[model samples]
Target: MASSPSHLSSGSDLEKREKPLSELTLDKPAESPYLNDALEKRVWRKLDLYVLPVVSVFYLLSFIDRTNVANARVAGMQADLKMTNHDYSVALTVTYVPYIIAELPSNLLLKAVGPNWMLPTMLTLWGIVATLQGVVTSYSGLLACRFFLGLFEGGVFPGLVLYLSFFYPRQRLQWRISAFFSCASLSGAFSGLLAFGIINLDGVGGKRGWAWIFFLEGIFTVLFGVVSFWLLPKSPAHAYFFNENEKNYVIERLKDDGATGKDASVDAFSWREVRKAFMLPQTWILGVVLFCDGTVLYGLAYFAPSIIQGLGFTAARAQLMSVPPFAVAFVTATISAFISDHYHCRGLVLIFSSVMCVIGFGMFLGSQSHSVQYGSLFMSIPGTYIVAPTLSTWLANNAAPHTRRATAIAIGFILTNSGGILATWLLGALSPAPRYTKATIVLLVFSVLMVLFSALNLGYLWDQNKKKRVIREGMDRSKEDPSLGDKSAWFEYNL
Candidate 1:
């Protein structure tokens, strides 16, 4: 063999070279500053103390404003507006129309305007519209207000997801996302209790209980919006509590964990990237899986009380009955997120939870007994909720570059909401009462499909991991042996 370079021939120089290798290969590698538990705990506490509460409250308001209409309907909103059953469905569909259309652009604006300003502004605008809903005297007026509510509230969820990405790494993000999303479940249960209280206020100042629903909830939303602007942190780099050293440590540690810094430039959206996203086997696979999820999700939200009311409860009692499923969902979602993070495996959790949903839906479809059917509904709700945040966090983790991740998340939401649209028609008034057999069947079909798609996605990712390993090995070997020459190697994540 040829003699080593003169620098490496010296014993001291060789030791210096070997020291780094020894350190890297050691059983306990040197821990990064950001990885320090004390430091991470401090940051986590800051986020928990300051950020989570604000975001949770904001999303609570958003969820209340968006879905409380269902409660309003139960409290005689349909009668007040002379809205036929079909018209009520139309109003629900109208909100989603603008919601689906505005999602992508709104998230892009969230990136530009910063969550501190954008989220609160969006909330304020929707609050104004939601309050206006209380004043509507005609079916057309309710439609107008619903459309604008969708327009404003459209930005809330996805914007929050993108915003969370700025503050935490992918693994830690799951719990927060689940916690935030649990607000919807919280709102579902709380809305029932609140509607119970507000309905008792029906004759107060000549406003109906339904009007009080919009008025009080809208006011709370507006106030929370104002508070959010003041309380929310701008970004990790700009987090007011952390020192300069801490900020740099956070940014660098995230980089080591495969997350690019907030300041790093993401590739602009291009047809090429769009094609890549669309063609990636995971994209369509997740799309279908999420589509199924959306169907069950919105179906339960829109029709749960209706189903319960048909089971012999009065309207108010039916609303109360809707509470348990959502409560179960909230608790299960939080637990699932923590478990998924603990294991660092999302796909298995998703598959298992989705199967729970299938079983729940199957029970609902097959059973005629009220208690058994309702119990199934409860199981289905939590299982579906469990899959959602995990699926979202999984998608966010797999996407590279900030812009691409944003695009992928937005696309996933688009697909999911499209399923929501399908839900509107599937669970229409034409469906039989007490049973809603058509709706139940549709839910069962989609839940099974969701399981299948999730399985397919996991398989694809496993194969992609294998291919990536092979390519990386080849590249390393090529570096060591020049005879292999220079060849570029690249691979895509399954989805």
Candidate 2:
């Protein structure tokens, strides 16, 4: 193991290349104290250009493939399949059953097989499934396709969150993750535009407009997946675009933030860490928060089209109307993320976002006026879209030892995705329309509950940070153990 002093020193090319995986260290003893602005800028530019775009594109397609069923419903899918209202809801629900079940195992596989291979491959499989959705003629076929689609799609979100932590430091992470996650909102807007165009091809091959939506989007996803397999780096040290110096800078930079536990040199998996993950209260706290957030987010994604249509527009117009709110959400979410990174506080933002949801959903429930209800959607998007990236970043910042973090992310996602199941059934059961009063009320309750939970979690982190500071003040430097890493007294939780 490299000691603190060893970390600050630079190694020769021979040392760098010859260093064994088990002996790899993230020390920066030889690094310059002054900033390498040009090199740093280039590194970020490459990441923004190469990494973020591919990841964002993958997620954009994922969201579209996952939620396009809602768009399909209004585009005449239900009538074509002769789906009862309950059958339509059942199709959505079936996807989540496999989705939630696969999350933990999929994240574990991400570590074992490597993200560059696992993520894109998963995308390709789901793309095939999504395209096949267009060919399904009956409710049973729809259910089967959805189940397999969910299984393939399950790994991407949590796996990506875990994969990203390997690259960015804690302070710099949320915005980048937010930037990637903003794709979901962008997808919402883009889905409408794409659907609008595809719907025009309604009789192009004797297929309905909704079928065309799935078929074309799925083809696009497959192409992107092939591109991603070539584009994505395996890890910081393995980045083909970076030289030795840049790779070292990347490693040292993240290690400085105590984020190197699962570096390229570390072992792939650890059962001990998996057990420890369950012991962290933050894991469950963040999971509960995600459950609340996921409900509103998926609820919006799965039903916004229906909601817009009920406001007195034709199906086509409703699809077009859905574009603006997500566009606004993209903007609002980006702004909120920048502020969150600037202040290094997720809790305040979490509460603010939840309040946005409460206000937006409340207005939707209370107001009979179409314009007011529609305006409420603009407020709701920022609220729902902001939570996942913010809260996921918060959990990523705190969870440690790569395995533990992966497990925590998997658990949180599994719980959160159950919210997807809830959203589908709730929408199906309440079957509210024109106002969707009952569903809106349920969303409001969850949103408010999230606010309370975020506040409590915030206080808990603050108190923990305070306690760690006290422990650090009294601890002897020589007696301190670097192996403890995030468990060390010097390791304070980022609020």
Candidate 3:
């Protein structure tokens, strides 16, 4: 087996790529003196500077385009299309069907083609579809747009998660993942502000105010997608912004961090790894958490304007009021993610977030005062948005090799968009406007479910870790089995 030094100091291609799967070394050497704490921090900071801003804008735009239907509804798309309440609900649900089915394959293709090409291409296609939503004269036309939009947007979020794993180690991923994911919260704020301004163009170009909303945002998205091709690099090894030494240092940090565990022998795509992801207990448990949390997350994002308007504000006032809760969530979500990373405990932070969500939803359910219900919106978003990034990071970190991690993330999001479908149908469409009693009750129930599932995941991971230790005490080092991946006696799951 080769040592760590041989791998880090090799030619431009990663040394791990050159080694046979069976002969790859598992231990990471101690850091060299030249790679000091200050220097390492500087490198990570520069990397963050390059990565976070670019991806964040893409995430922001994608979210705005997806959820802007709510804003359009407030400005009058439903009446213009002659759609009933249930029809609107059905429209919301339609998107997730293709969104769920396309994700796994999209991720696998990303592994083949790389993010540099795939992500931009998808964004541009989705953007064109979003822009066409403005021209759809009939309900069927709207459904077609929604379905195709879902197909294109499906891969982007999970693809972002898998792509980040290429550059960051498992333990260091939480905050960086959160940094980009926080853009979802920011999008809520931006969309509300944009809606407030765009709704004034009620008769522009012989189109309604809602049509302008779609037209303007979609145009911006198309332009951004084209620009992303130049901004996003294929991998750290091939990053254009980095000097040769910086590229070497970045890859080396990631390799060193893999020493403790979650190291699989095969770096190439494997069918075995993909199958193993389906069988892992954590994947389904996390999926349950995702379903519960996503019920609230997308509920708020897709229906916040409606919910707030239902709370007694005019449609215009509701558009402006939707801004603050999500703005606050953007800050709290980032702080909670860093706290989880600092403690190296994902499930506990997840449990805390779920508990906060329960309180938020409960307040909305029980209170008659609109003021108290509005205050409760603050709790809803921060609590729910925190789950997506943290839960994805936890699942991706525990699953090994590229293919398994990709598969697990895709499956988890299948459940998430499934929850989104339930949210729109249960909370928005079936329930009456203004008093959304069903909305509060449904959100409250899901919040409690999230808490229970998070606790179960915590206990399960702890028990599994204890079992691994017991096995480690009896195992022989010379007979170490790399094939076990995360199940190996020496591997420890970050709780």
Candidate 4:
């Protein structure tokens, strides 16, 4: 391997020429178990089965437990507690404050403790807090529960994104991310149907239907968390079900795609990489794009029941109506993700997704008909759902060195969930009952902003690739430094 010359562009690659290729993307595969194409397929199937499904259920339960509070509101808990729209919005806002504060620290802790410990612990704690929401007697009690739930749940989304990156290369990651993340859409449908049934249990065991919604759903999370503590493999290499050939394939492919540390794991934390992630242009730029998506996402999650019920339906009927849009979104997000992976494009897919948001949210503001506004949700649900996996994968794909990628993911999530804080207010406080024109208008404007920003991101990344191509053509860049990561001439940005 040729050493990086002092004149070979500026920055970290020049700063640490002596750093091992382990910190940079490996150009060649290391020695591995006797492996063939068929064996590789077999290994990936195991990963998809064991890893993907397990994590999906973790997120599904977590999301359901979190959002069922909305269902509870419609089922009569809000009135029972004497809460106003402002009080409900305040409780929801309380959740997101902790959520944003805890994002980076939680990812860093996930790195320190490993997913098996950090994820299951967080899941179990949040589950307990969610269950306790059922028994709260005052508005203050509800606020306290929401705060703890946010603190525990804050890490799950970013943690899952980082955890999956451990096993798959950049190109293949978005689909797997989609596969699990699609569960987020499913959770809404599931919450609706579950609330529909459980709310029927009102007056059973001296508990109202809304109370059962929390108790039953939270208990389910607790049981799942206990099982996950045992079921989840520590990492790809530690997956006991995989044969030696499968393990090596996972390790080698990841390292070839720029895994750090001995044995191609995520590696120990680096302050320099964390700082590098903070300084990247994409970190803040795309973070704003996510802010728009988060507003729509939580708007739907927190207010969908109320929004639907306001459309001249009974509360229980509204719960059932919310199901189909999410069902459609689950399928839409899955298909779009496959297309994203197959085409190796994130920016265009994001633009298309954002445009769907524009059309969907626009209908709410543009039309006076209830059915038309209701119909728009079909498009709106999938639009916002698609953004998270695609945008998060884009950052994860570009940032290199394990710590840098992980931090970039956390930062993106922070900016993403911060929008949820505004969502509680906009979709709840700013937009009142019976006719939420204000919320509809806000969603529409944000959708347009997202479309514009997605285009900007695509243009910027394309120009960056052009510059890197020039550097690659002019130098023996393979020898420069893997530490350059996505910044290196060797890496072609996925546009």
How well is each residue in 1-495 modelled by candidate 2, as lDDT tens digits?
A: 113233324555345434432255434322222234344577777777778878888888899999999888999999999997788778998999999989999988886788999999999999999999998889889999999999999888998888888788777788888988999999999998888888888978888899999999999888888878898888888888887777777776666567764254443477877888888888887788899888888989998998899999999999999999999888888898898988977899999998999999988888889999999999898789988889888888887767778888898898889998888867776656777777888899999999999998999988888887788675674476544545666666777
Each prediction's number of clashing residue pairs: 1, 9, 1, 1
TM-score of each: 0.88, 0.92, 0.91, 0.92
| Global CA lDDT computed for model 1 | 0.75
lDDT of 3 by residue, 282-317 (tens): 999989999877788998999899889888888888
Between prediction 2 and prediction 4, the one with superior lDDT is: 4
Model 4, residue pairs in steric clash: 24-482
Question: Residue pairs in steric clash, candidate 2?
Answer: 7-27, 7-28, 7-29, 8-28, 8-29, 8-30, 9-29, 9-30, 10-30
Clashing pairs in 1: 282-495
For residue 310, give model 1's deviation from the true position in Å: 0.9
How big is the positional error of residue 389 in model 3, measured in Å on the Cα after superposition? 1.4
lDDT agreement with native, every candidate: 0.75, 0.83, 0.83, 0.83
- Cα lDDT, model 1, residue 348: 85
Q: Compared to the true structure, candidate 1 yields what TM-score?
A: 0.88
> Which of the numbered candidates is closest to the native, going by highest lDDT?
4
Model 1, range 1-495, lDDT digits (tens) per residue?
123345444656535333322232112111222133334567777877778877887788888898888889888999988988788878888989999888888876666677888888998899989988888889999999999998888868878887887777767788898888888778888888888778988989988899999999998888877777788777777888776655655565555444442235433434454445555456678888888898888777777777788888999898888898888888888888888887776888888888998899888888788888889977898888888788888777666555666767778888887887777767766566778888888888888888888888888887776676687663542243211111112323422
